[model samples]
Target: MKSTPSNQPEQSVQKTFTNLINALEQNNYTNFISQGNPAFKEGLTKQIFTHVSEQLAPRLKKGYSSVFLTKLNQQGYQVYLWKLSFKDGSDDIVARLSLKDAKVAGFWLN
Candidate 1:
């Protein structure tokens, strides 16, 4: 299904991780980089963001934004919003890595 960002989590973290692992188990990791157009890649990245955000945000108190993504450079990984909130009035973040090797990575939300 096409992924749409929202203000909440769609499932649990364990479930998101399991789905990612299952997807990897079923396909080669390098294929996402080598086999798709930019739009397709973006779509995949959004899906990952949605899944991770849905799984992690509920454990925190502040509101998390549904969309956040930027490619830092040609090689550096793009940052996608898995979760974004306030902790002590500072940005708290949980995100997924969109490098050819997809994985979860946490960072300061700001």
Candidate 2:
């Protein structure tokens, strides 16, 4: 889809996505939610972050990269998609990140 100013711009958010991965690898809960929106920061507790970090740590350590796919404007957020490829040649995963007011609102992989 074409870019829109209302939704957070993709250029900056792309870099944030990389930072998210870095946070996961390092298990830095503070850094992980540092850029999150107020609601996101409140909702994503350190316990939750720790759990996710532990789960994804292996793949993260193996190294990975993402390719921007598209961005969708929905429910007052900018939903960005990417193709996440692991360096270990594991199957690729679809990564989704939602941003509100230029901050991360939600994120997941499928």
Candidate 3:
């Protein structure tokens, strides 16, 4: 799909998630999302909360809770970045995901 200003990021994120979920569902991998990026795509996978916590422990700011998803163009492919955070000095988690073969892959905690 051609990218648009209003919903490009959301569309890409949804597509990436759907692609991963569909592939797992078709293969009878019901616990795919819950399993957390077990299938590596582009050398990235979903990171555990523990891993995320450690990364954000030092950079967290107060009242800065928010989750975000962004679509980026890289080397001729689309990449997605997701960030989850909480308010009032809470930990923040960030992940980078990529799409490949109609599947979500390549996750990293930031």
lDDT of 3 by residue, 29-69 (tens): 33334323445522333344334444444444333333446
Off by over 4 Å in 1: 1-63, 74-83, 86-91, 94-96, 101-110
- The residue ranges of model 3 lying beyond 4 angstroms of the native Cα positions read 1-12, 15-30, 33-66
* TM-score for each model: 0.25, 0.84, 0.44
Clash pairs of candidate 1? 9-54, 10-54
**Cα lDDT computed for each candidate against the true fold:** 0.41, 0.85, 0.49
- List model 2 lDDT by residue over 1-110, tens digit each: 89555433356887899888889889999998998988889998999989988988798798887778888889898898888889988888898999888888998878
Winner on TM-score (1 vs 3) = 3
Indicate whether candidate 1 or candidate 2 has the larger TM-score.
2
Any runs in candidate 2 off by more than 4 Å, and if so which? Answer: 1-9
TM-score, candidate 2, is 0.84
Q: After superposition, how far is residue 10 of candidate 2 from its true place, in Å?
A: 3.1
Candidate 1 lands at a TM-score of: 0.25
Best by lDDT: 2
Candidate 1 lDDT by residue in tens digits, 23-108: 34334334323333455455556456455445444434343233334334335543334444444455555545333334333222
